[model samples]
Target: EADIYQTPRYLVIGTGKKITLECSQTMGHDKMYWYQQDPGMELHLIHYSYGVNSTEKGDLSSESTVSRIRTEHFPLTLESARPSHTSQYLCASSEGGAGEKLFFGSGTQLSVL
Candidate 1:
């Protein structure tokens, strides 16, 4: 089993509205990441953290930013969400490579109007 969490399994919001997608972990892992995906789509790394005090944006960004809100809460914040931001945001954490398999919880499928 994986030790990760997310809320609002699904959400529908109008354009220009702000929303925060919550993520948390209990495994005490130092590495955390956020991947965006859709049904039948690939998981693209959108954000990640190497440790508690470090944070960086990923290679991709339609419109998503995440803060190490806390060691356990790596919530994604969208200053202004649009329909294009409508998709799935997944939160994950790992210890290292090789044995580091991605553990995912049910993603938050967002629909912006």
Candidate 2:
């Protein structure tokens, strides 16, 4: 398993504010994903990429966007955050297989007030 880290661990901002959650992986992984979840709720995949320069929106529709400019970095950004955007954002990376283990970063808890 690779070590993944998310910066700021926590964030709070007013509505209409723009924010970015950072996620970085130590090990190079081709498959990466971002999931959003509220307290006690199921994780909803919001973004993912097969590799660099390849990004796809996941199952859940999101107001945020993600970019994979480097192999070790994936950052999620919200142009205009709202109260409805409050949630825990999780980042994970895998070796790209059906049953491969995923390396997850400490999530970023965002609060938009």
Candidate 3:
């Protein structure tokens, strides 16, 4: 099983409020990723980090940003939250290499009111 974790499992916030979604893992994986999804919809990769201090934006367009300062942690930040930003944020980690399976966290559901 994956040892990843995400905080504030659910959040309700006002428009324009800044928020940070936290993700961490104990598996010592060097590759981490963030995906955005709506309920009952397909997940889209929004951000990723290959290792500490290396961050990259994913194929999907997102207003959120991310940072990777430690091997075990990757966090996503929304500078100005909006109702359109309301969605589920999932964190995942994987052992580096092609065809490696990703281990996902419980996920964070955010609502901007």
Candidate 4:
């Protein structure tokens, strides 16, 4: 098992539904991240943090929003999920600094019909 976790590995839902992708880490790392990937492609940064109580939106266009309440738990919530939001949500984390490798969860594959 990975150090990170994302629930509902696969989900199918109707339009206009609210969904939340859960991500948790046990490493106690201060920097956590959320990314979106298409089937198999490069990682797209959606959200990240510096430390406790430090959250920032990433350099990507995502309708989703995330919150960092604890150092180990970061969750993404979609107020109204749409078909366009259908994709894989990946969570990752690292110790600190630039160029550090990230440990990623298997991911949550969501599909809205």
The root-mean-square deviation over C-alpha atoms between each candidate and the true structure, in angstroms, is 1.9, 1.4, 1.4, 1.6
lDDT of 4 by residue, 14-61 (tens): 899998899999988889989898866787899898787888888888
**10: Cα error in model 1, Å:** 0.9
lDDT of 3 by residue, 6-113 (tens): 998999999999999999999999999999989788999999999999999989999899999999999999999999999999999999842598999989999999
Ranking by lDDT: 3, 2, 4, 1
**Model 3 regions more than 4 Å off:** none
TM-score for each candidate, following the candidate numbering: 0.90, 0.95, 0.95, 0.92
Candidate 2 backbone overlaps, count: 0
Residue 20's lDDT within candidate 1 is 92
lDDT scores of the candidates, listed in order: 0.82, 0.91, 0.93, 0.87
Which stretches in model 1 have alpha-carbon errors above 4 Å?
97-99
Error of 4 at 23 (Å): 0.4
Error of 1 at 46 (Å): 0.5
The ten-residue window of minimal lDDT in model 1 covers 96-105
Assess the local accuracy of residue 12 in candidate 2 as a C-alpha lDDT between 0 and 100.
92
Q: After superposition, how far is residue 86 of candidate 3 from its true place, in Å?
A: 0.4
